[model samples]
Target: MMAATNNKEPQRIHPHKFTLWVAMGSIIMMFAGLTSAYIVKRSQSNWLEFSLPFVFWYSTATIIISSITVQLSLKAFIAREMKQYRTLIGITAFLGVLFISLQLVGFYNLESRGIPLFGVKSNSATSFLGIITGLHIVHVLAGVIAILVLFIKAYFSKIKNYSSVPLEIISTYWHFVDILWIYLFIFFNWPR
Candidate 1:
């Protein structure tokens, strides 16, 4: 047996970013399992099919905008524009809260239309929707908390670290969550 003889330099990645990638892969796997179960269960009897709430479109737009702002924040920080970076981070955090609010409103809109998420009347479709969306919201909230931490650090730290790693990690996570929402939105609305 010939030993492997190829020598190639390995690219180095920040440890925190590598950890985040692993966590994101895990999240993707979990969501894939849930959605796959949703598809299989959908083919069964009593699977209720209804239109998604209109507020979902608004929520989608909000999250997309937040992703942009997060990118802007990183750029500002890298440019050493402290004021602009702080402003962008604040906006991103606000948009995060707004997105969660919109999600809750969408849920309420569904329930008001006789599509209960949890109850004796709840169907598998709505139940899966609630679970999937609720989990996504939890992740979004985490992103928001990360934003706040960055914001506070930007505001109050007497010593200047000037490292972009924290902001870059948050930006990546924010973008991932945004992309995940887009995928879920399309998954829910795609015609059968």
Candidate 2:
């Protein structure tokens, strides 16, 4: 008797989606740890109660807008509209840069008010906030780098047939990071 052969094809998991899930999970863990620490320490003595920097709200809005633009880019790519995709990608890249700039401005504003966003160590609370925001800022910088790489790939590469997967992954990761920041901002602003 001849050996039976199965005709079923293996389902291919998109590598980009897998990567996005991994990146999002890592981001969630990072922010989860930070927020947990924030709550635990806020309950402790000598936790300086201060108003969160207003610029954080602005930065949050900007990042949310950027997420939308990135989604738009992915949709355009899926529709095979190269021109719209390119334009949206460029817009998303610029928004990422703008978000970083806003974050920097927020740090500066906080420091000008003596709130130690960039390494002010007056107390444990300040230190914690400084470190938490700093770490998140570093993550934001990584997102910016990822977007820049995406922009370059979309512009210079000739692999136009199936190049949108990477962008889709990066976009999802970027949006996840943005939402994480909003969650953090709310947690930090919550009254004890």
Candidate 3:
């Protein structure tokens, strides 16, 4: 029996982590720009008075829960518990979907409340709010897609070995986004 030679270590590091961070940083910058624009616009006169969509609160809660689940998944991976890891990942993805659905519901609630979100012509506050949430929705959609990809890789692929680095990376990014949303919510809807 010949001992296996050619012992180059397998490149176990996942490629997605770097890409996800780059993408997430871009997303953070995008949101920061929107929030800055909001600050500038809110300072202007003749801005219509309106309350933020209530669904935002619900969405924020959902994102927090999703972050918790992602953390659990990362812990499971560290513990080498494949079933719990996969289950937690699935739960996180479902929470992502729930977050998106809540965003749409928020838009509907705003419409029902007669808030105008039409481009530049809309009231300054509404316009800024619309842009902020709209960009956030786009990012959330991207996150949902990423979650789906993770699901497919974790469940469907034959790759059973769970890498702790990838799981932690995903959790880090997900938690950052989740916290960002909470900050935005408080900033946008804070009582004057």
Candidate 4:
């Protein structure tokens, strides 16, 4: 009897890419736990219903723009357009900063409206809102840092033909954070 031999080699993900995915999974689980807790706590007592900060809309817009720029940067990199890649990545980084700034402003705006953002003064709903959004901000900031590092590497290094893996990773994470914000925005606005 003759047997056919398989010729295809299994492709493996980059270690760094695998690590990022694992971290993202852990983050998703954590946020799920938090939202679940918020849902449970809502039924208990002292759940203050309030409008989401308006500045969050601006921040959401900024993050969405940043995601687009990061994606364009990746495409530019793939096309070997160093100048365009640099410019797009720079825009992405700027938008990331803008998003974070808007988030802080939104926090301040909430405080101005007498909604306690953090600490002992906060109620269940406000506290959960603060914690969840704060965690998301941290994740977005991590993505921003990654973008800035890549941007710097692109400019400061002598190598013109840089690898696209870093850009791809950054773009993926940036998109993830952007999508996460969209999910959260819809979640907070959902009718009870």
TM-score of 4: 0.94
With a 3 Å backbone cut-off (N, CA, C), the pairs that clash in candidate 4 are: none
lDDT values, one for every candidate: 0.97, 0.79, 0.80, 0.89
State each candidate's clash count: 0, 0, 0, 0
**Model 2 Cα shift for residue 97 (angstroms):** 1.4
Compared with the true structure, the alpha-carbon lDDT of candidate 4 equals: 0.89
Model 4: how far is 56 from its true place, Å? 1.0
Q: Which regions of candidate 3 deviate over 4 angstroms?
A: 1-25, 119-121
What would the TM-scores of all predictions be?
0.94, 0.86, 0.83, 0.94
List the lowest-lDDT window of 10 residues for candidate 4: 157-166
- Which residue ranges in model 2 land beyond 4 Å of their true spot? 1-12, 118-121
lDDT of each residue in 1-192, candidate 4, tens digit only? 889999899999999899889998999999999999988988875789899888888888899888889999999999989899999999999999999899889889888998887788878798898899999999988988989998898889877656788888888889999998999998998998
Model 1 regions lying over 4 Å from their true place: 1-11
After superposition on all CA atoms, what RMSD does each candidate show versus the true structure? 4.4, 3.4, 6.1, 2.0
Q: By descending lDDT, how would the candidates be arranged? A: 1, 4, 3, 2
Off by over 4 Å in 4: 1-6
